[model samples]
Target: MKLYTLKTEIDAVPVADDFIAIEAPRPDCPDGGIVARVIYLSLDPYVGSRLRGRHMGEAPPKPMEGAIPGAIVGQVVKSRAAGVSEGDFVHAMEGGWQEFAAIPAGHFRKLDPKSAPLRAHIGVLGMPGLTAWAGITQLAKVMAGDVVLIDAAAGAVGGTAGQIARIKGASKAVGIAGGPEKCRLVTETYGFDACIDYKAEGWQAALKEALPEGASVFFENVSAEMAMTALSVSQTYVRGVLCGLADAYQSSGPAPHALNAGAIIGKRAQLRGLVVYDFYSRWDEYAAEAAAWIRDGKLAFAEDHADGLDQAPALFAKLMRGANVGKPIITVSEEQA
Candidate 1:
């Protein structure tokens, strides 16, 4: 088997020193386990924190050792568990950037390739979709007349959150993205009521224009200026779902923002930090709803693809810098279907 592992300690944007590839022994399907051929690997900003040994709970990937962990979509080639079979399509959160992975059955979910594209299971139908659903539907509790604001609106979780807000009957769904193209996609393709181009001059004014009445729910992904901007225009009883701090992911030093504490205090706003893994048990519920949204053309998503496993390291660097328009995905192999 081929595996990509951390090559050395990294600071700033990850470079070649941050990753290396080597041959590894093929894994086995242990009791209650399934060995699958990796087909798609998802690159996310939080992975950078994990690489830097900042993630809690699990031991961080050791420099120049251990397989780099990630969410993956794959086809089962062997199974030692009940109700699982060879050639089954599956997805796992703790899988690595390896050609094949042997995961406990409890850690993997079977995917229906007939229902949607295999890779979609790891994109819109996977963790990103679930994150969007949890933050918008539960934490924010978006209502029909609510106005919603989403940061990083062109990215996977943000884009889906915007669309889901609209689907749940929000009066206005506004997005904040970095470029004209992403802004266009957020509004035109993803069906947000408006998208503010944060990279453009006077973006604050643009945000003001888009949310004339102020936003009631904030699906925050990028913190710092974007977060402060949203907090500034928040309405009474506003709910903010704190998901990712993409802006601070690669910063070498402190990335601080002057949040208007008065605004939150005066509005009685609620800001809740979310870690999607905590809500994994509800995956089936979100997957069902998201699948219907995609099937009905009510939701849309995009992927920025890197062709091979060797591209994982550079892909992470590019994604951290916001180079990708949507979810960053590495194609591990052709789907075995």
Candidate 2:
């Protein structure tokens, strides 16, 4: 077996040699565990913060010893648990940066390959997709005629949120992304009504111009400054779902943008913080509906994939820097055994 371990404490964006690949003994399947050959590794922006012990109370991986944590899709090769059999395709959060993982029985979910592509189980039809669905439908309650706003619109969560809003009857879906290419993807590919390039001068004004009716719902995935800007132009009683802070993940200290309490009060906004874990119980419900949407051409997703486990570190670095165009994933092995 081969795996990548942390070389040292990551200070900012990981560079070359941050992760060292080495051989290890294949993990034994425990009494209530299953050993599966990893197929796809989902590399999210939060991994960078988690490596530095900056994420939601997660401990940093020990240097040279701890395996990097991530969500993975794999086919079970050995099962010691009841209700699971060999060759069962599953998705689990504990799958590390390794060729094979020993996953506990209760820690994994059986994935229906026929529902969508196996890779989609970790992207659009997976946790990121669930996050977008929970924020838009469950929390924000996006309704017909509502104008929706999303930042990091090229990302899995934001892109899916905007599209879901449209599916749920929102009149217009607008996105704020980093550059022109991402903006183009948001509007042209994801089918958003408009996309504003946050990297360009006067983008805030551009966002306001694009949403003439004012945003009725805002699915926020960037920083507090961007959130405040969105709230400033939002309609009265707007629904706001605060999701990710991509800009603050690699920061050395507290985020520079201070939250403006007045913005929430002035707009009488209904604000909610979204933690995808809270909606885990509803995965099946969301996945079923989202998969149907995909088949019907009502939903879309983009993936930025790397070919092997060795490319994980570089691909992850690209994600933390907001350079990835879509969900960052690593193809560890073939999907089929």
TM-scores for every candidate against the unseen true structure? 0.95, 0.97
Candidate 1: clashing residue pairs, number: 0
Clashing pairs in 2: none
List runs of model 2 lying over 4 Å from the truth: none
Q: What is the C-alpha RMSD, rounded to one decimal, of candidate 2?
A: 1.2
lDDT of 1 by residue, 1-337 (tens): 7898877766555654578898889897879999999999988777776777655555667766678889999988999989988988889998888999989869999887777777887778889889999899888888799999999899889999999899998999999999988998898889998888888999898788888898999988887566667888878788889888777765656667446677778888898888898889999778877887888888888888989898888887788677778788999998854
Please, what are the lDDT tens digits per residue for candidate 2 over residues 1-337? 8988888888765654688987888999988889999999998877877888888999988887767989999999999989888999999988989999999868888889898889998899888899999999999999999999999999999999999999999999999998988998899889998999988999888888998889999988888888898998799999899998888885657777567888789889988999999998888889899999999999999999999999998888788778889899999999875
Q: Candidate 2 at residue 138, lDDT?
A: 95
Pairs with backbone N, CA or C atoms under 3 Å apart (clashes), candidate 1: none
Worst 10 residues of 2 by lDDT: 250-259
| Most accurate candidate by lDDT | 2
Instruction: Report how far residue 280 has shifted in candidate 1, in Å.
Output: 0.5
TM-score of 1: 0.95
